[model samples]
Target: MPRTQVTGRTGPRRALTVLLPLLLATGTPLSVGVPASAAEPGAVRLPVMPSRLAAGASCTSASHEVATATPWEQRSLELPKVWPSGSGAGVKVAVVDTGVSQQARALAGRVTAVGGATADQDCVGHGSFVAGLIAAAPVKGVHFAGVAQQAAILAVRGTDDRGVATDTTVAGGIRAAVDAGARIIEVSPALADRSRTLTAAVSYAAGHDALIVAAAVPDATTTTMSTDTPPRSYWPADEAGVLSVVAVDAEGQAPQGSPAPRHADLAAPGAGVIGIGPGGTGHFIGSGASLAAGYVAGMAALVRAADPELTAAETANRLTTTAYPADVPRLDPYAALTSVPDTATHGEKPAEEAVRLPEQHTDAGTTRRALLVAGGGGALLLLVVWASAVVPRGRARGWRAAARNRPTGTS
Candidate 1:
């Protein structure tokens, strides 16, 4: 069955307005794709800023050294708390982006190159960086720990030379991952076009109960040039059956005045994030909905680990329910792991017959005094009436006796 398509209110023109500021400041379009082979025809490749690690040609032996971490490492916010150790160990997370490097020491056992018929290998470093965010196993010597340290990743390359991810290539990569039995699918790419073939593939993944996470597209046009609204549209992410995510900072806050309705469902650490840069082990810090999407993907792995039987809808519900409400609230890990349905009903009750509860009685002494006062007043009134009646009758009798005595005396 075809899946439902969620149409976002933020169209292309508005996106351009919001994105114009960054574009003008950078003085060029942000190239975002890394293709496997020669550039595809008519594909626009945006120049992705290189990673800090990219300066070094080969992996260093010292990159494998173990190191102490920060408090974030101990908190569930940094790692998957719901999934037990080794639970998601075998589960593969298929990341459709630039391919992962086979020689990266951190990805030694965890990375699986899923290059097939659809897309090229990781020519640019964007896909590998996302892969690291999702499942980079905790290296003793590494600076950061991934969200799902044990979850395996299948890297599917989809970008072209202009740093653009095409609709056809992206759809092909998604289908490939589903066919490969990926338990979870993470997509950071949002193209300009929305096709039936692409939507159907995403729907198929959801129908098969696979959790999909995607980044909300940002604005693209320069805002300084015009008073008119700029383009602010994002495809695929705005599509149905995909959990859309918005960017948040380390303090757990999203951007201000972010386009409502089309904003991400959850927020995660986005600002000042440290990850591998293009083609090298360089550390790159970035802020965007893409990072937020990665956090949701990690959380989804945790959810699946906790309840493997959960459907895509149910899993989404858990994530949405647990998500801490932010400016553009993204997914919440603690809430998703522990949220329940709210059964509360609202509105006032209808008027009905009033029912009274038992009232408190006075003490025995106080009651006795009240009764005595009432009894004594009644007794005194009765006594006074009786005395008055007797007195009257006695007076009449005395008068009658006096009259009789006087008569006798005369005789």
Candidate 2:
């Protein structure tokens, strides 16, 4: 798939202008700053989830690396299922987050920094943690490498230590990954609303047959009992053409009882998950849906590796349909690639065909001709789905805004 540039302000001033009054009327902060909007008391915040990779002591002769031999090895992490042979070895998984530490032993030769966005330096160790979870190499003592150590990674820094991400930077990172030919895009950060730039960027990536995965809102009741505000909703997850993932415990249980939306595609091991830390020294117990999303992304790489012809949507559906629901369905990596139905299909209940071609063509560029031709149809279909949800709500809000500004005095 060819890369296309996405343009447009994510949060328009007019909409925010109108929404601000209502927010203030409800006793919420309406300040013109992002932090202020985020800092409002009881305002729900996205979980600072990290996909901890390798953090345990290395047993290798190498000094900085963890000692390969340790008691942790005996009791260390185990793959939920056997790593599928010939799974996602050559495919690339793009990590869109804080940034990665290029010096880490497991990812030394595998990390590619997106120019102008973030170098291989990770100030807060967040990006490195996410990267390790997706494709960390096997340590001499540590038995479990990541889900796909053979997969390459493109690290696009979307946030820093302070935990902030602007839509513009994130959108640029998405376009950069698609332009560079990324097969699976892992977006750990969540946007607050369905902004134009984010929605378009997702469509643009999906048009190119790139699978986009992101974190869902955290389980409010399970972890924290904050009631100052309503439970937060995650964007990109809520948007069309993207798969939203929620986290589950080691026992394969969702964090909260909150039912996932129709868009909630899959669940992965999330709570108390361990992975590599900065400098490749030791491991840490990370929590939240971020790691779960990474696990799904790695599994997605394997799906793409197994069948290069499968579209992103198809890959997602395979994962979703085959997922084992522990109450809610959790991703089952092996079943996604190998499972097939045993029934006839003359006019039976049509199995949910995952890949639907696009309906319109917007000139992203000419370089990705093969991708454009094959994936454009599916891309257009996703666009229609996106429009159905966004356009009507926008028109209704516009009318409401106009009414709010109209002169009320009798003429």
Candidate 3:
């Protein structure tokens, strides 16, 4: 049987006017796939993992292929620069999706199920994949790692065993995550229908100071309804207090067939992204706005860990406002962690005072280069000033000397 595609709205809507040029200017390569020959001998090539299984399909198997090349998303996000401030330690991020597997190696000893054992079991592997994106630890040889490596994952079931989700399940997941004291809640599935239950659940989470991050659009699959469907809002994401995230490719373009949301707070790398699956030392490839939401949730954990004093709303504001500005602002983990919030431009009321974070550890080479540039600029300015002052005086003195030499005889 063909795998069931997780789908809702379809068709791309908006172009990333400035994001593509910014990415290209940085010269970060845009490919996520590592060729089979690039892998160690005897390592199998990674396969595309399914978001959901067809009615009676077998469970997702362990992948033996390990991605050795650094994923483009990792390079683009520049997570290493942000880690010096915090690695998301002490932050509990709730993954409300198909469920996270405890068997995933990278996430070992960090996952806690919310309701029951079912929430810890991942038959479809989608939740585990999402979880890995958020908090997977660094492995010896693999180049892939999660955003907040020290963060903990709270696994909650927003979808059934086969990875099908409904309004009720997702709403319940939010409430459960909030009640469990998860600071950051990531909702993976994007439903087409808007439910009062989901809205209230989001409000409940907000009231409890839980940051809810959700997918702005659904995952694209072969089973998606149609490519011509008009863009519309997705639930939970469209709700207030929820951070709606859209997925962009390496080139900052939305993946084909993945409809753009009417409104998205941030954009993240989601297309052709690589991550670990349930019970795998190897990796799997997945895509969509849902994956993008996972990235945002991880970054939120980092922010919360670094500055526990910031309210959930404040944390969200920091992430969005500090992002690389574009149609939908691109997620900049380093900026979110390091940049001071400017309440004026955000139009939000100022806090008691601007909370300044400690100085971040930057690359020595980069710092040295910056200092050199500053020194050079200062020297150039001094030269310009000296020339401006001396040239005029010298010209005036030469004119006076010529007049003196003329001895009152010249016209």
Candidate 4:
């Protein structure tokens, strides 16, 4: 796919407004074209499998860099200082991307498929790479480890083998991750276009108080001719309540193709970042905005583990505000673990009382919509599923927020 200049959209999310109307009127399904660097099984070089398996094989020597590569990488982000307090224990980060490989050593027994079935397996290797960045176990002989070494991975496959997924599939993946008890969701695709399905899914996750960490720009792109018609933008990342992440190098400089400063919430080291790869590649170099997003997701996990009582937005706010610069913050795992949370509780007093936001939908209208959804057929099925599944979760989140903020004496 050729790199296109920005159109009126000015970011990666162009033509979404146009894509939504076409989906509803013509019922045409638009597919997401994941960047080749992020997807394509044949394109990704898997590690050479060992003839005989050892107890804890990591293949550390296969790496092109020195053994100290990973330690330096972690030090750049200041991750060591926070590991003792919270290695993301008791946190589940939903990875929405290519499926995760079950046999990746760093992720052995750590990955959970979203559905009850034996799915969420990765063929293209991208999802496994992303998963390792968030929560891989420490390799026996290598200096490498995930940012949130103890966090569990909720693997949800949105894209197919070719790294192509429809907006509907991506949306469903987000909802599934939330329902599967993921506290932090890592959306690894930077889709070429946008859809109502994806927007609704984003809202559903936010309403349920789940933090969304999304990859932006080059890691996600459109293979269609419309990609030539820019203001280039990437979806889900551009959506509200989602943390947009960009890739930086060890020097902390954002790359050329990443989301502009205005579009990104944080940056993390992605250039030459070492990650355990799919099909037992042990640990290798991976780079992109997707990897950067994975780092942020891991940080969110650490923050949530420090205090599972935090709301999604509250957790995200802590990470963003305490970053290295505080403004356009860079990922600072140490600060996320040590800093005071915005919603900290002390002596039974509430800090700033939460103002109740208006309900997403009035009761009568919701009931009417539910009835219509049940009565309708074909295309309406997706909407009906969302109503049945996401609505209740949203309501439960609201109640939880209310109870957390309820006055000490008032009934």
Candidate 5:
């Protein structure tokens, strides 16, 4: 899908503005996705939150080198293959979390903070890290690349420097992000309860064809007290139209000791991820469902940049339908970018093959069948050659035996 179509909200979007407020008072306060036990009941954010390697690391240079940076997450997301089509240029992605720093190297010239939280400042650092994962400009030789390098970041600070914010504040942040022309809004916080204002904000964003990606489901085994309360589930993500992302580790399996994400609409690498820090060229390491959500948002931006005509829901459907693993449809940016069906042939009823995944991104079945065909052909050729050589040898041996027995007396 190339960036040719103009996107506008569908008919249902007009109704969301009317229908959203009704939901405001209906939902309860279980909006925090982070297990209260794992993280204090604060900003409802990603589950794969990373720990700081060095809180006091210096950032005196133009580009900071995080020696302990892990590129595995980027590789697993297959970013290298996805960059050529579009680096999310012309798409606005809102990072509605802690404020993003104006001075960060990766986002130096590309960030704009909306509303009145902190102007381009991520003192808590979570928002900066998440922003880096989404759109950090590539620095050669540093092994650093964001999912959508050219995507601009609209930093909407819903949380404070302590990584804490009231639901109302976060909800306002969401609304501001929508007004800032964000095509994709990445809400990184979880809440202990649903805020009607927040739900309304999310609804408002959807009304504009803006896709909201959030991590709303907590692991089933996540607990608050020793009494074993269920894992946290939050708003926006739990809301009707949001795309919920779940965290997977380097192995693409459930992270150790964490509860399995049962309600996740998709999964991504969230553990041990490295991201850009707010102050300098340095970096911070944290993993959580937030990282995965950010990655999905960045990918969504790519889809928008590649084809701006797709509606938010259609965009989301494309993501889920085109994702790999078939079962979970894990985010696959390359396939999403290159697997566009020809518009001339894309009518109401098109051939399945014509609309199917790009040949380069075929499933394992295709490769396995190819291997089987090649192996069968090789085995048949080997059998034919063996028969040709062995039959003649057997005949000659038989003739020699007969001559040895009869010719001695006859001669």
Candidate 6:
């Protein structure tokens, strides 16, 4: 089998425009002005963490540079608006990667190593960075935080200490995560070849009601290859019962030379992404499909926490169905949490039970604001009338929008 090395590139951050309305509607605090920390003199600079190390490379060092600006993904995902309803509480997400470090301060007291104590040691720092992207807690004065701050992490080593992954190790990691009762298993390795064992592992996870999230392509390639190399499938991403994720930048564009996967279920903020490394208050910059998978897994945790009754398949469906329409749908975490599924499209009769928000979690004012946001300040009655007329027509047309029909692009 032929292999191509994937590379990481940093892109300029663009401010997200659509989230402000939702944030105001939810009463989530927004920091419009620059923080005092950004102006401080002699701030420590952060390093870029490597996805893998070459032979004889020294172990990754801890970063001391703290990030003060909020990551673009935070604003793009509208995390603040969704945090009030679901903080991924009680959800167990497995990070099947190099390993997750116990020394990461934000992930302290939340990570459980699956294979052994060695599984808690992240020499490459890739696993620890992915874990931070999923569940790192809020730190005072730092704007960077995980998507699911309250979710528990199950660290399983799918790669060796130097960050090389094999199908056997990755297969075992998936099974281990399933056996550990993880609600969501995030597979960071994007192996070049598929294996029966890995396919079976994905099946086993689905059998046990675990949602498996995987990177659509390798984060970093080991050797240089031509940019025109045709796209290929990687596993267990190519396997059934998996949600394959690709990385996109703040501008919703994939990095140059990114391998286009045959079947990417979602695109997330992955390029030029900021995260914490092992044993650090500081942050590191990383990019690729693996990091994108982390974001999807965190969003899955939130959906599972928000609606505990949703099955693994149902949860995956909810995420894809509510995603912002695109060639490969862009993840909209807020929509995944709040939007009701369109069951009629699934050929199932609509349930008679009314969908109700938990009053204990949402006040009357918040509810009114949400309604206003949905209706664009029009009367709720008018919105309902519009939906009644348009929804049936949308269903008749198979819900195919003009955007979805456009030429497919990478990420």
What are the C-alpha RMSDs, in order, of all predicted structures? 14.7, 26.8, 12.1, 25.3, 15.9, 20.1
lDDT of candidate 1 over 78-100, digit per residue (tens) = 34454454235666788876556
Candidate 6, run of 10 with poorest lDDT: 16-25
TM-score of each: 0.60, 0.62, 0.74, 0.65, 0.66, 0.74
Q: Between which residue pairs do clashes occur in model 6?
A: 5-221, 6-221
Candidate 6, residue 308: how far the Cα is off, in Å: 1.2
lDDT (Cα atoms) of all candidates against the true structure: 0.56, 0.61, 0.80, 0.66, 0.66, 0.79
Better candidate number, 2 or 6, judged by TM-score: 6
Count the clashes in each prediction.
Answer: 44, 28, 0, 12, 19, 2
Name the better of 1 and 4 by lDDT. Answer: 4
Runs of candidate 4 with Cα error greater than 4 angstroms are: 1-68, 115-120, 220-232, 256-262, 343-411
**Model 6 RMSD vs true structure:** 20.1
Q: Once model 5 is optimally superposed onto the true structure by TM-score, how far is the C-alpha of residue 7 displaced, in angstroms?
A: 41
**Model 5 regions lying over 4 Å from their true place:** 1-65, 68-70, 218-232, 257-262, 341-411
- Which has the better lDDT: candidate 2, or candidate 6? 6
Q: For model 2, what is the error of residue 407's alpha carbon versus the real structure, in angstroms, after optimal superposition?
A: 99
- State the lDDT of candidate 6 residue by residue for 1-411, as single tens digits: 122222433322323122222321232322222221223465334566677776787778787667687777788888888778778989999999989999999999999999742634788898999999999999999878898999999999998888888999999999999898999999999988988888899999999999999999877442411245567898999888899999877677665445677778888988667788888687876667899999999999999898787888889999998898877888998889889755564557866877778867589888888887877856777889999999998998899873565566845
> Positional deviation of 367 in candidate 5, in angstroms?
25
In the range 186-206, model 3's lDDT, one tens digit per residue, is 999999999889889998998
Residue-level lDDT tens digits of model 5 in 1-411: 010112344332222222212221121111111212224454222222221213443222222335233366777777888888789999999998877778777787889989865665565677887888899997755676789999999988877555666778778888898899999998877665777887888889899888999865432112311233344456667777889887665555433333333356677766556667776765544556677888999999998898888788877877887787623457787777777644543245653665655778587998788789999999999999999988898797884543445655575
